[model samples]
Target: MNLIPAYPEIFLLIATSAILLIDMFVSDAKRNITYVLSLVALAGAAALSFYSFEAGAVTYTFNNMFVSDPMSHLLKLFTYLGTAITLVYSRQYIVSRGMANGGALGGEFYSLSLFSVLGQMVMISGTSFLSIYLGLELMSLALYALVALRRNDAVSTEAAMKYFILGALSSGFLLYGMSMLYGATGSLDVNAVAKAAVSGTIKPTVLVFGIVFVVAGLAFKLGVVPFHMWVPDVYHGAPTPVTLLLGAAPKLATFAICVRLLVEGLLPLAIDWQQMLTVLAVLSLIIGNVTAIAQSNLKRMLAYSTISHMGFVLLGLLSGVVGQSSNGAVGAYGSALFYSITYVLTTLGSFGVIILLSRSGFEADKLEDLKGLNQRSPWYAFVMLMLMFSLAGVPPMVGFYAKLTVLQAVLNAGQVWLAILAVMASLVGGFYYLRVVKLMYFDAPVDNSPIVASGDLRFTLTLNGIAMLALGIVPGGLMAACETAIGQSIGHALKNLASIAA
Candidate 1:
């Protein structure tokens, strides 16, 4: 077995364990040492991922259960960036809330966070059912703990319990679906399953039956409507940092698994799964946008906004194929990939602003809290404005380009109505997003305290907001990166997908 493909995961695991041991002797007052080490581990792993990147090439290890490819490397790089920035943004917030100190979360937040990133890395690299499931559980468990880390917070406890229960149910759905696929295909490896799915020897009916549960599981993870009951509650109830933790990095991992399972593993059933995704996309867009309009709680509104944005991602996923052809598969999937990456980047900034406003005694979670932010600090307010514009899919921001590409992909795939519907949904969604901007620029100041954030947080938040506009103006590079990554993986799979479409 070529262990070379697994180096990043292995290094992360070892580094995380060492951080745990080293932190045991360090006092909470000196916890910055642990924080520094955690960031170093993430940076090291990111470097390794970048070094190993190979366009249009794939490598496998651990008896082919772990695969390293361009897409994995790219997503892993973004994952590292997202996780590190999340820590930087939330560092003071965590300390102020006592999650970094003695009686509550202790130093485990750092270790648990690293471990969760490791799990996400594993998930991004997973090439088989067992590996994917193992990775999912690891990440889910770490996040569950992180959610309840504030031991005395009744809301955190409730949120953690709900997340755990829903998470467990989703896992069960995934495992059952995998078992069904295994029973039909007589294999656990994704490649083997792909082969079996297209072979005339296996029963297509059985595969479709299994795909239902699989899509259900995937839908739950993506936080689309119907399966999205847990999202707003959890996002509102969990500590803001944990909310960012749950929101950002894990999305790339989930997108990876969705592609790995549905596109790579079961391209033969594209038509069936695409239909499922279509219904999910429509419902998510309608419900997520409409409900978000009613929320005064900023976190919950963002949570619903997450659902609608995910619907656009589903649009790209489902647009990969038209009947009897793999036409537009690369562009469609690439658009979805690009959208996911940019969405996370935008989300990190938006939530970072929320965290920046939160003091030891203040949560800064209500919509009114953002009132007259521009009057307080024009720079921070400007950053928040860019992030809101991005989320609202306004032009000159990355979110606009992301949506445009996905809509183009959908149109190319012959879903003209879907594309139109997506545009309308975005228009409706823009109201709440722009409402925030209104509060920041026009509303009276509710509190006049000076905005204070660590230098690192401010630096990253500034860069993050700038990246949104930068990518929108010249989205070619990231767009091409996503296209190339998806094209490399889809090159062979499209041949099979063609047959399924036919």
Candidate 2:
């Protein structure tokens, strides 16, 4: 088998091992070596992904378990870029909080992050349920410890405990679902399962139950309503860098998993799943938007906001599903795909700003903490204003387009009622996002509120925040990318399933 396509992950594996060895040998005085090495490793991985993308589809090793098709390569590229940004913004935050190489933290944080990125790579390239779960576990386990890295802090410990316990429980549900799916189809490959789904030999009840459980597990990761209890506390109490990871990279992997499992593995059952997602989307929108209004902590509020965004995504996903519903056959799959892509960029920018609000012992997580931000730093206030405005679905902001695209997708599929609910919730959600802007620009600063960030941190945050505006203003490139990626997944699955059936 060809190996060129596997170069990125291969680089990541070697780098991860090297960092571990170096961290063990290096003295505390030279511990910065580990940090520097981690950055270089991530940079290398990013380069490899980009180079592979230019060369086009390349499948290498394990009979297709690790293919670097355009969709996988593109998502992997974004994942690494986001990881690099997380490390850059987090370096200073980790240092200031004494969360690097001292107390309960060290080079391990960076190392774990590398492994998590590796997991995401595996996730995107996964061709079978086995590969998907392997990636999911690797990512989740690293995240569990990362959340609790600040061992001495009670809040951190509690958050880690809750996340770990809940994460474990969710994994069980997902595994059970996979087991049922395998039993019904007698295959572990997603394409094989899709073929079986269309064959009509599998028991419908078993298939439905399995699909529900799998979706349930995914909902936990996506922070959808009913499965979102862990989000606010975990986001609030975990170290800020860890919170950034929570809000950003994982979304890509989780969405990838959902696409592979639901659309690819269970394509024939799309109608059933669509109805289920409708219920989830509406409830998540109502709860996420309403509860966010009461949150005083910025991280917690954003966590709730993320839940609402998940709802919007679910709405789009359901629309995509209903395209097959005999009612005009208008498809929203393309729209759903675009919505996930933009959501990733928008949310990452929003949280990156929060990570940079470091002032020695302060973490700037509370809404009141941002009082009169404009007076202290108009540039930051402007950046944050862009993020908040985008999230509020205001015109010309990326968040606005992200929401509009999904709503349009739903309406296209004739799910007008669901589209209307999403619109109303978007309006409700706007209140909190605008409140953040009002706090930054309209309110007076708390007596000593002077926000300061490291130079690198400030620069990256600005770039990330500015990107939202850039993408929102001219989103065609992103829109095309999303359509291509989603179509890639669908086409691949259909081709494989058709071949298997014949």
Candidate 3:
């Protein structure tokens, strides 16, 4: 009955409400108070999550609907950090775009983002079907509104509608799948579902059907191929700040639910889901990388790049359960986790630079917008160069290590062909990423306007871009953390399975 497991989420919920109320009373000139308070709330939540990690082993609360463990704590901490960084980077951009003009729309942007973070925390800790669904819906609903925050823009409105419709459809698929699983296993608890899956008492055909729908729904959230129809349009249409929010931190929550659903709840069905993920992984890699080469818009290109990167994550996940033995599970899942974290880090800086370059009435979203970036500001251009290199998986950047680890894990799982295909796809994807670097370093200036960013934005982006190289050079700590988290979680799940059997 200890409440420690839910403390961070509880604190975030309260903080979000307080921020919303306080924001309502603040004047337009004092909106910075809301911004600063929101950042403090996120930092506080992160501190709580880190402190809760001292509990060590996995602990369940609310009748086992929510579980807290090292993995959840670490992911939650990063989610807080990611969201905070997004807010900081977006502050000037939001102001310049009139998104923070002391209105309902302005206030909702911050409040909804905090609520979305609350949902992400819930998703990270959720251990039951209902808990996970509630988190997913909360996050999705907030994002839908945020996408359309620019109420006067027709494109923004259209993108929001498309996202809402597709998002609702995906939710229906996920709920139906959950219902099927509940019917087949007679339990909504993830551990109970796993036990039932392993007992050979349920109908395998029905279980596989549910798994397909669940995977499809999860794939849509992750923006993989065949279900990624909303990504480019939304990224293109939303305000840059909103697009940044969409592109970065939510992926952690999505990955969290994927692990909860596929690994914790349905490990016994690994053979089936792994095969399905193989198709998804392959198609995402091929299409994401190939199509990105043709995109002139920076956001659209990054959208495709995100798809390809997620494909690599699937490769890591699918490789974990190769032949029934969970020996490779730690490495496989750890690689995916590491990849996800590094990707978010890189994305924040990438979009931060975009926001910095953008000003009133200018989007700075086109490829040509980056031309002669070096001539305007060599330091920021260097930052952009590192980000592009990292995204392209060039050597000595964190992205390279991230890709290498996943490929190594796939190879360790005897997925040599999959590994090879991943390498080829990365090579293809590198072209578009390097094109950005070339634009910044080689091409002449298009606007010749001196790049201006707030001191906070500059500081955050500089550190973020540099961290890519720093982590790449010394990736052991983060890699070890990922491995430890995954290993402990897997060990805990196995222990629960043993207890259930006894």
Candidate 4:
């Protein structure tokens, strides 16, 4: 089998291992080497993904257990970029908190993050249920450790325990569902399962049962309602940098898996899964948004906000196969893809600012901590304003367009009620987002300490914030990229279906 399709993953594995080994020999004063190496590894992996990407090419390897296409390439590239940005935003916070002590903890943190990124890459390229499960576990295991890295913090340890227990339960649900699918279809390959599903050989009851568990597992990963018990605690308990890592990049992987399982493997059973997603989406919107308004902790608020944003993603996904309109499928899925990317972009900046405001012996995680941020740093206040407006889907922000596209797709599929419900949910969520802006500009400073951040942190945060407005002002290029990636992925899926039929 050809190996080019797996080159990026292979390179990451080697680079991570090398960095881990090298980190052991370095002193605390020289720990910057390890951080630099980690960033370089991510950059190299991104370059490799870009180098291998083609407009419409799809490559499958390892007996078709892995597949690389435009969707995977685009997602992988962004995942790499997101991880790098996470590291950059996290460096000062990590150092200030003494978590980067150049000992086992620091080394483990960086290495584990690399492995987590590697897992995301695997999930992005996986074409078999086994590969996807393996990747998910790798990522989850690393996150569990990262959450507990500040071992002395009781809250951090407690959050890790909760996350581990819930995460393990979710994994069990996913595994059981996969086993049931295997029993019905007699195959572990996703494409094979799809063929069996469409061929009318499997029991409808068994398939629907499996789909329920599978969707539950995926929803848990996406932090949607009914399975989001861990998000607020984990975000609130974990160190701010770790929380940033947790919130940002893995989202691309979660979305990738959703596309693989729902759109790729189980398209034939879309009606059933779509119904389930509709219910989940509505609950997430209502619960996540309303609950977030009650949260005084900024991190906890964002965690709930994440659940609601994911609700919108689900809306786009469920709208894709509502009827027999092929164009509707493309528009709906493309909109979801665009929404996911923009959400991650905005989330990185939001957390980056939080990290910037944090210093030794202080955690800037409370809503009150942001009062009169404009007085502390007008530039950062402007950055926060842009991020908040974008998250609120206000005008001239990419988030507004992202929501518009998804709602339009939903309406196109004759889901007018769902679209209207989504609009109402967003309107409600806007209150909390805009509240942050008002606090920054209108209130007096709680602490007159000036915000101090590394030059790298300030530079990255500024660029990251500006990207939100820039993309919002001119979203055509990114929109076209999403459409093209989704189109190519659909074409590939169709080709696989045709081959299965033959």
State the C-alpha lDDT per candidate: 0.92, 0.82, 0.90, 0.90
> What TM-score, to 2 decimals, does candidate 3 have?
0.98
TM-score of 1: 0.98
- Total backbone collisions, model 1: 2
Model 4, residue 147: displacement in angstroms?
Answer: 0.2
**Better by TM-score, candidate 3 or 1:** 1
Give lDDT tens digits, candidate 3, residues 1-502. 8897898898889999999999878778777888888988998888888887755678889999999899999999889989999999888877778865633226778899999998888888899999999999999999999998888999999999999999999999899999999999999999889989888888899999999999999999999989999999999999888888888889999999999999999887888999999999999999999999999999999999999999999998998876567778889899999999999999889989889999988989999999999889999999999999999999899999999999999999898999999999999999999999899989988899877789999999999999999999999999999999888776755554445445
Regions of candidate 4 where Cα sits further than 4 Å from its true position: 100-105, 492-502
- Clashing residue pairs, backbone N/CA/C < 3 A, model 2: 101-106
How many clashes in candidate 2?
A: 1
In angstroms, the error of model 2 at 401 is 1.3
Please give the distance, in angstroms, between residue 270's alpha carbon in candidate 1 and its true position after superposition.
0.4
Model 3 lDDT at residue 65: 96
Every model's TM-score: 0.98, 0.94, 0.98, 0.97
Candidate 3: where is the Cα deviation over 4 Å? 100-105, 494-502
Q: What would the per-residue lDDT of candidate 2 be over residues 1-502, giving only the tens digit for each residue?
A: 6777678888999999999988998887677787789889988998888776766654645765656776677788778878888888887777777875663237888999999999989888887888999999999999999999988899999999999999999999999999999999999888788888877787899999999999899888998989999999999989888998888878888878887888777867877788888888899999999999999999999999999998988877776644344222123555665666677777777777777666677777889888888898889889999888888889898878878878887877778888888889989999999899999889998845555677887888889889988988998887777676566557755454344435
- What are the runs in model 2 whose C-alpha is more than 4 Å off? 58-61, 103-105, 323-331, 447-449, 494-502
